[model samples]
Target chain A: MRSKRALRYGLLGLSAALIGVGLLRQEHLEVLGKAVRICLECVGIG
Target chain B: MSGMRRNRIKWPLSRQRTIQLISAALVNGYIAGFQKGRIFTGGTKAVCVPVLNCYSCPGALGACPIGALQTAVGGVKHHFPFYVLGLLMLFGVLLGRAVCGLLCPFGLVQDLLHKIPSPKVRVPKGLDRPARGIKYVVLLVFVILLPAFAVTETRVTPPYFCQYICPAGTLGGGIPLMLADPALRQLAGWLFNWKVLVLVVIAAASVLIHRPFCRYLCPLGAFYALFNRFSFFQMSLDAHKCVGCGACERVCPMAVEVTKDINSPECIRCGACQTACPTGAIAGPLKKQSPR
Candidate 1:
């Protein structure tokens, strides 16, 4: 039970750290840039 | 014969089905674009919803995590995909495959298809056991490795899964785009035909078999399944109350043996088992008990 709790916390902490760094780096804008454009390749058009 | 009997059982409108419908509608609610027959290119598309929605869909407001992950990994500037991974981990820890059962639009499609009045086919256990591993392979290869490593001369990675394999992308984005745009329709070729064929086969399979894509092909489902055992939301069996009748297993669309493994990776947390449980032995998001 202790181990399970520890693992959960560990994962949560890692995720938080990753998200924090991603936000700091402004990686979301990159995602936004890609999302806004309709990629013809994605739908097998190209 | 037993499977046929179970399928014939009149399943009344349940809380889970209601939730699924609302979730699907809410996720794809950007109807203004639908009228224009144009995909939303708005700021909200930056945010990835925790479902398998295509950003290229005419009415989609949010980005798809899988597509975003592929794009981030395939990008020339940054290859780590910290944002997508973090977001996915957050969703995984919170809901696990409960996202698949209650939140995904594609999942709703599969559920509705399986509900069509037709002869159902149960995947034989011998083939089913190994086939379940295929989704994991898709996650590892198509969603991750292929996009990250299969680079073009311009250093951009191709969205391989969306291009070649994703029926959801074909159905949600491609068909709509083709229907709306005269130029896109003219561009349709062997690749487009191939995707249409793939979508048709999967759609046909979903009618006979419950969630064939989710069971054997969805990379997103594969990723979420990893968190099933430890997610904050989880299914648990009150062994004391269970009569071992196996009714839960009988009704389970994901083929999960709920009595033996309440928290199995394949269990979608659709609450079918809970609704079917005669003694209410099954419960979820259970409060942690004090260690004895």
Candidate 2:
């Protein structure tokens, strides 16, 4: 993969990892939202 | 027939449309998946959407950022919405309503509705700024103060903005939920009818006005405005490259004066200016970048 795309994927992975931890530890509405928020933040709104 | 020159017909395919669709899909998908589980277990935490979506809407996965913040401010406890504010700032620092342009499903829906061939209203400048402030009042008063003071419970409820005004809730979650479940339908009353009326009016207005709700009534948009000055993913106009032709402003559906400053709170980073500029003066990051 191109370096930029690869780097983007890496960042995505890291964010997902962090969000997954947040979600697993707290199943509450506010906690689950952390996962989606993280995904959008990393993706940069397409 | 003589050899006559034929005009090439170009298809209208803007990258903005692609972005809006993708964001909507992701948010909607998450909301659908989230309903199976409960989000609030004990404490009040904030969930924020980068775009102006409603939190109470059944399909919403993340708490509406504006809603959460308002509720926090409005609820009797009146605590700072650290998570919601932080999350909103995170996106604002990164995308700057590149979220509104590309990812907001509701914004996309409005855009699609505006596509209908019809007479449209270009809100005059005299009324525009004042109109934009309404959402802020919503953010401050309805979402924040009311819940903080008016509630029976000490915990903050989702702000009234989502409950009464968010068209996204009416169109995305309300309509669908009512259609799918009899229990939800039975629960519907004058309040539901009122929401439906509001949605219908907004939907109709969208055909004539480009993103009327985003232009005037989205508190989430107001929050993003605070970060536009330094957002990493933004349309920067190299003043040297910009000839001040005002082409960007002319094409902007939101009617933002792009060359005045790249950091205008009103700018949605729709990339219209980038395409419109003959000098290639405008550009945005393909991915979120660390703020400068």
Candidate 3:
């Protein structure tokens, strides 16, 4: 039971850390750059 | 008999359905944009919603997580999808498939289709068990491998799932775009027709089956299902209160054996089982639990 709790916390912590890194690196901007454009490829036009 | 009476009175708009409606409206609330047949290409599009809303949907305010993940992985730059992966992990740990049961726009569509009066068909367990694994295969192949490895000379990886599959994109983006733009109508070809066929099949099947796509084809649902056992918001069964009546099992849309595996990956956390429990054995979200 204790181990399970530890694992859960560990994963949550790791996810938070990853999110922090992603924000710090401004990966959201990269995603935004792609998203704002209507990609012809996504809609089966390309 | 009394339970049956209560359920019959509640009929078409059950508590869950009401929640589903509100969620669908809230998530896809760019109503004016839909009216104008324009997709919102705003800053919010960078952020991934937990649900399977097509990013190109006229009314969608946020990007689909599955679509964003594929796009990020399939880019020419091809860095790891840290933002998407982190968001998915965070959502999985927090809510699991509750997002599927309540928040997803596509999920609401399936639920409503299943509610239509029709002869129902349960997939035989023999075939169903193996078929459930297809979503994971989809996640592994279409979302991951094809994007990462199947690069072109220009270093661009194809968004295989969005291009070839994804009935949500077909229904939400393709139909709406074609309807709105006369020029886009000329661009429609074999691929567009194929996607329309796929959408029709899924839409037709949902009337007879409870969430055929979620059960067998949704990679997002498959991803979230992996966290069902450990998700913070989850259902628990009090053995002392349970009479082993199996009423919960009967009410489950996902067909989970509620008494045995309350935390089954297939369990959508819709609270039908909890509501159906005569003894009130099932409780949810843990924070709502009374002191033992």
What lDDT is reached at residue B66 by model 1? 90
lDDT of 2 by residue, B37-57 (tens): 222221222345677665434
Q: Give lDDT tens digits, candidate 1, residues B84-118.
A: 89989988888989999989999989988887777
TM-score of chain A of each: 0.85, 0.48, 0.80
Q: Count the backbone clashes (under 3 Å) in each candidate.
A: 0, 12, 0
> Distance (Å) between predicted and true CA of B188, model 3?
1.2
The best candidate by TM-score is 1
Best by DockQ: 1
Q: What would the per-residue lDDT of candidate 3 be over residues A1-46, giving only the tens digit for each residue?
A: 6776787788788888878888887888877776666555556565
Deviation of model 1 at B90, angstroms: 0.3
Model 2 alpha-carbon drift over 4 Å, by segment: A1-46, B1-12, B30-47, B55-61, B70-78, B153-158, B286-292
Judging by DockQ, tell me the better candidate of 1 and 2.
Answer: 1
Measured on C-alpha atoms, candidate 1 has an lDDT of 0.85
The pairs that clash in candidate 3 are none
lDDT score for residue B125 of model 1: 94
Q: Which lDDT value does model 3 have at B34?
A: 64
lDDT score for residue B241 of model 1: 82
Cα lDDT of candidate 3 equals 0.81
